[model samples]
Target: MKWGLLGGTFDPIHMGHLRCAEEIREIFELNRIVFIPASKSPHKLDAEITSFYHRAQMVRLAIEGNPSFSFSDVEHQRAGKSYSIETVEYFLNKYLKSIEIYFILGQDAFQAIQTWKEWQKLLLLCNFAVLTRPGYENMGLSGALPEEFSAQFTYDEKTSGYRGPTGHHIYFRKVTFLDISSSDIRSRVRHGKSITYLTPDPVRHYIQKNNLFQMD
Candidate 1:
């Protein structure tokens, strides 16, 4: 089976994330998409974030209706900061090559690939489905990695993706643009504003019930 892995802080999952995952799943013919909430992000260590339990619960509520959407707390079970490489390796070992893993992320996030730990190896480990905004050009692994490093991948006309040394491909495709964001939703809630239409009704209710994002 084809699986898509979407990892994020997911302080609160919103429509944009859900929509992007849905489109990516359809485009790549993925059987299901797993939403993994980071227990602690290395990049956002200094920043304030919601608790892992709460974030995971919010994700569960957000994707409850979608049978193809599932949630995982693998990071929470591990110690220390959450890293994408470890998560990818975990899935690889568990599935034992039975399933094709596609690491789904946004173009902006992909552009900052160098900042991630073991980024070079992670790219070659599994297929990458970088979600670009509508109308963006398909410049896979070019602007994201160094010239010498990216030269390893060759374009395959059949797959329409760049094939890495490990036989995994990096596929770049445009997804429907949704202007909504979790940060904006948090800001609205902190200021006593409505977040309706920004996220699913269940997620909105969950945030309110848990009193998340409210000023102390």
Candidate 2:
């Protein structure tokens, strides 16, 4: 079976997250896409993150009806900072190397992957489907990729993707860019602005009921 793993803080899951996962599932013919909300992010350690319970619940609500979509709390269950390499390894062990795992991430995250823990090993472990943002559709390795790993990928013009040294490919998928962001939603809510369409109705209600992100 082929699976896609999308991990994030998911302070509050929104439409943008759902849309990206949906598009990738259809485009790649994936069996299922698991949305794993991180307990804590190493990159955003200083940033104020919502509790894991709320983040996980919001993810569950965001992907309730889709049979192909599911949520996992693997990171939450584990201790310490959530790292992609560890998560990928866990999935590999749990699936016993029988499934093809694709790590789904945005272009920004893809570009900063060099800073991640065991990034080289992570690249060799699974395929990457980086969702390209608007205006970054034609981006190449020179500016996007780190200097050290530039030679690792050989560009294939026919497919507009990059093949790694190992057989795993980094597929840069051009997604329909949504102007919405989790931080922006939080800011709006903090100022008492309506976040009706920014996130799902259920999620909005939960936030309101709990009074989350509201300024003191």
Candidate 3:
């Protein structure tokens, strides 16, 4: 089985998030796409993230009707910083060992892989699926990859992805451009700006109903 793992804070799930999942499902012929909302992201420590319950609920609403899409509370269930290596290990152990796991990420996030907990070990667990963000693809080797980990990558234009074996295997899938960001959405909401197209209608309504992001 081929599964795509898209993990994020998902403070409030948005259209870009949904679109990216859909696009990747088709592009990679994935059997399922699991949306994993981080309990606490190791990165972005300054941002005021919503509670795990709220974030998980928003993700549930966003992917409700899609059979191919599902939610995982793996990070939330596990204490401490949400690390990809741990999350991937959980699925590998609980689910089918023969399954192919693709860890989905944006180009910007992909560039910062070395900063993640057990970053090198994460590559050995699952393949990476990177979405093309504005100005990210233009970054050369130094910009796209870490100096110490450059030797691990093997590019394949046919799949628009990268592959490397580290005990297991990791793949980097280049996807369609989607500029949507949770930060932009949160900022708009905080400033009382319209977020109509930025997020899903249900999520927008949920945020408004709960009065989230209304802080001064």
Query: lDDT of all the models against the reference?
Result: 0.92, 0.88, 0.80
- Could you give candidate 2's per-residue lDDT for residues 1-216 as a string of tens digits? 999999998878888999999999988899999999988899999998889998888889889899999988999889999998999999999989898998999988877788999988898788899998975554666666676776888888876677788877788887777778999999999998999999999999999988898887
Ranking by lDDT: 1, 2, 3
Query: lDDT per residue, candidate 1, 76-187, as tens digits?
Result: 9999999999999999899898989999998888988999999999998999999888545656777889999899999999999999888999998888889987889999
Tens-digit per-residue lDDT, 1-216, candidate 3: 999999998877888889989998998899999999999788867777888988988899889899999999999899888888999999999986777898888877878777888877777677777676667664533576676675666655555445564533344445565677788888899898999988878888889998887776
Best by lDDT: 1
User: What lDDT is obtained when candidate 1 is compared to the true structure?
Assistant: 0.92
Question: Model 1: which ten-residue window has the lowest total lDDT?
Answer: 133-142
The RMSD of every model to the true structure, in order and in angstroms, is: 1.3, 1.6, 2.4
lDDT of 2: 0.88
Q: Ten residues in a row with the worst lDDT in model 3?
A: 165-174
Q: Work out the TM-score per prediction.
A: 0.96, 0.94, 0.88
Pull out the clashing pairs in model 2.
none
Q: Give the clashing pairs for model 3.
A: 127-171, 128-171
Candidate 2 is scored at a TM of: 0.94
**Poorest stretch of ten by lDDT in candidate 2:** 135-144
Q: Which regions of candidate 3 deviate over 4 angstroms?
A: 138-148, 156-160, 166-174
